[model samples]
Target: MTAKPPPDPAAPPRSPWPGSAATAPARPPEVTARRLVARSRIFRVEAMDLIFSNGAQRTFERILGGRDSVMVVPVLGAETLLLIREYAAGTDDYQLGFPKGIVDPGEDILTAAGRELREEVGYAARRLCDLQRVTLAPGYIQHGTRLVLAQDLYPSPAPGDEPEPLEVVPWPLTDLDGLLARPDFTEARSIAALFLARRYLQQAHQAPAADGKGRSAPGNASSPSPDETR
Candidate 1:
């Protein structure tokens, strides 16, 4: 009789999504909205006239598109991750997460990211990597979040006129696994960014040793170094 092979140790557990484990049947279209009724701030006051679909006349309240922002996944001291705790007026309480801010009109994404990093964390990064873009709430709000990987940080005097009172918090990066295990870490985009940034860092740390070509070590990309972009 032939012996059966053991299951692959690296295989992930079965779940609906890799990170989240909920499963539900696909939902049908809620309504075939053909025209917008109005557009206003705070989501309710309407202004512009609505345009209807040619064939099917459906209508929905016009929604104001939300602004875009950049969030930093800051790694410090080769072992710690930087987070911020601030009062969110919307939530009416203090919340903990990465440093982030809305992108101003006519501003570039990288510049905005750097500005937010410094304003919120009081540190500037020599190297900033574009990680990914995420839509925070597609169902209601239209906010977009651009994830950034910041490293080689140096202290900088914080901008005095920052809107919020942000407190910088640093915890060992190894505690990320424990943090994810907590229910408070359920912010989907933050969790995703945290996981992905850590993975990228690990990969970068394991890349071939820097040679004369001047490639950065894994988890360390070029910025102040060669073979890397700003």
Candidate 2:
């Protein structure tokens, strides 16, 4: 089961994602030199010189990034998933995906998620669950994005730096197949977040409910979550 019996708060979670029979291979090549080749308003490109274990030398260019990002799966109620249709400069077109942004220098992922949700979707979540961490262009880039599952939404809007108002689309979670079928919904991070969040929610909803004294009981009925009182 994805959700194991609840453990001590001091103890970390144990139910890691299932693993494959094939273990990870040997360590990567050693970097010999790294030099910044280019810099733009938002990105920095670096040239890297590396020598493989077999003593083969190769040079490669990679985007240099340091800030961690948060992409939130904002669920309105139990079945609706909130997405934003924003103009993507990289593609020069409107793309559909979850509300996301870079974490500020001093901000935590949860805080950044709340800010992005309010700015992009006009909602704030009372419960923010950290589903997993994902990477972008691992072969060429060094940045990680946090996948967050946002629930218990409430109406709250904040100002954003977008040049245009983003279109908010609440799609039924059941039509995830349809969402994936669309040509515009093509962000890898967003797609991964959707699948991960679905698995997490399904596991959580089906897991045994905990009693008043923190004892788990076998049942389909869910106890009052934080959102229930709101």
Candidate 3:
């Protein structure tokens, strides 16, 4: 067989996942001007005039002024995850997803995550790991939500602003496919958080022990012993 052509150094880096090879510009576009376009009780829309490095100019409208939020994936024990079903005002239907809420002024992200967990699912996590920060739509939305993985959960209900009590659903962590197949679990942020949490748990399970033993780290609830797996 003929030798494959040399890779292009200027080409965008390839992603492990298919059809995801693209890179951001070396320099971001300059914002020439911005103006408030609309305002509602809960949302403000702003228009931005930008000039790209390539001399292309465009005006984009983005939602602004919302506080950054936190989404918590609460792992109960080693296998179960706690989810909540609540009425979604935008969709006009009840949806199932991880507990999430806006971070209050002067509140920490992890603290906000724990509070949302307690408010929505009646549980608090002793251990919380920040998984990632994700945006809804970078092209039009300036909103972001921090994904957090929570473990070592205990009951700790708190009053919340929900019009009705949320329904807590217990799901097996091993049955992530089953959860994904459900119609009600359609929130994109929640879906992304699920995979992020899973990847983190897997990495933690395979990490070397601190004592120099050839064993994995201990006390990770998500990791089952070899015997337990068998």
- Largest lDDT belongs to which candidate? 3
- Model 1 Cα displacement at 228 (Å)? 14
TM-score of each: 0.67, 0.81, 0.82
Q: Candidate 2: where are CA atoms >4 Å away? A: 1-27, 212-230
Pairs with steric clashes in candidate 1? 204-218, 204-219, 205-218, 205-219
Instruction: Residues 1-230, candidate 3: write the lDDT tens digits.
Output: 12334456888766667675355445567888999999999999999998875789999999995688999999999879899999999999999999999999999888999899999999988887777789999889898999888899998999999999999999999998899999999999999989878877776677666665544443343344333432
Decide which is better by TM-score, 1 or 3: 3
Error of 2 at 13 (Å): 26
95-210 in candidate 1: lDDT tens per residue? 67888877889887777878888888888887788777888766555567888888888887468355756788886888877777754445677788898788777766655667
Q: What order do you get sorting by lDDT, best first?
A: 3, 2, 1
Worst 10 residues of 1 by lDDT: 221-230
Please tell me which model should have the higher TM-score, number 1 or number 2.
Answer: 2
Supply the global lDDT for candidate 3. Answer: 0.84
- Top-TM-score candidate index: 3
lDDT of each: 0.68, 0.83, 0.84
In candidate 2, where is summed lDDT lowest over 10 consecutive residues?
217-226
Q: In terms of lDDT, which candidate is stronger, 2 or 3?
A: 3
